[model samples]
Target: MPLVRIDVIEHRRTSEQLRELADAVQDVMLETFAAPARDRYQIITEHRPGRIIAEDTGLGYTRSEDVVVVQILQQGRDEAQKRAVYRALAERLRERTGLDPQDLIVAVSANTRADWSFGEGQAQFLEGRL
Candidate 1:
């Protein structure tokens, strides 16, 4: 399972647009990571202006107030697949929500399958219940 956390500046996007952005990210995961539809898990948080700061890392790209920070936590995947996911997410989100690629920041964290407990306080993957 992949748990996605999206952080953005408050009032930058409507609720509907945020939903679309989440859907776009999930779609990329489904296509590139082989994630099932039932694996969709996401959290969206809106922060006040200046609370979330992002720099261009010397890329000379200026970030706007509409910046979106997406963090995905899941099991390990190949680097190629991860890169593909990033590209797909940027493309799809841009197309669906008109979000600039420069404004999107994505990060992924890997953990063991045993780290997840879907329900019943059980580690589903480790117990072969996933």
Candidate 2:
């Protein structure tokens, strides 16, 4: 399995909203990648608006407002599949918050199946090779 890791750069998202974001990403993976609903891993980060800087043509590099960045890390998948999943992700975000597609940038990191664990000293997804 190619481990897909996601890093989301966001601007001042509420705690509850952050959780929703994680779930949304998981949903996308499950639907597009054909991953099981139980097979899930997501990380959500919230950043202060004044702290994060988004490049806008106007405003001369001001802080971003109401923006979310999603990073995804997954395994056991190819590039085409990964890109498709990302496109789906962008659409979901737009549907959720009326945000511009440019506001969300998703990049999937490819990883080997050897580096994953679900619980206490367990690597079930690894098929016990480790």
Using lDDT as the measure, which candidate wins? 1
- Per-residue CA lDDT of model 2 for 58-108, tens digit only, reads 744332365555656666677788778878888876676555666665666
TM-score of 2: 0.71
TM-score against native, each model: 0.96, 0.71
Question: What C-alpha lDDT values do all the predictions have?
Answer: 0.90, 0.63
lDDT of 2: 0.63
Error of 2 at 32 (Å): 1.1
Model 1 — TM-score against the truth? 0.96
Cα lDDT over the full model 1: 0.90
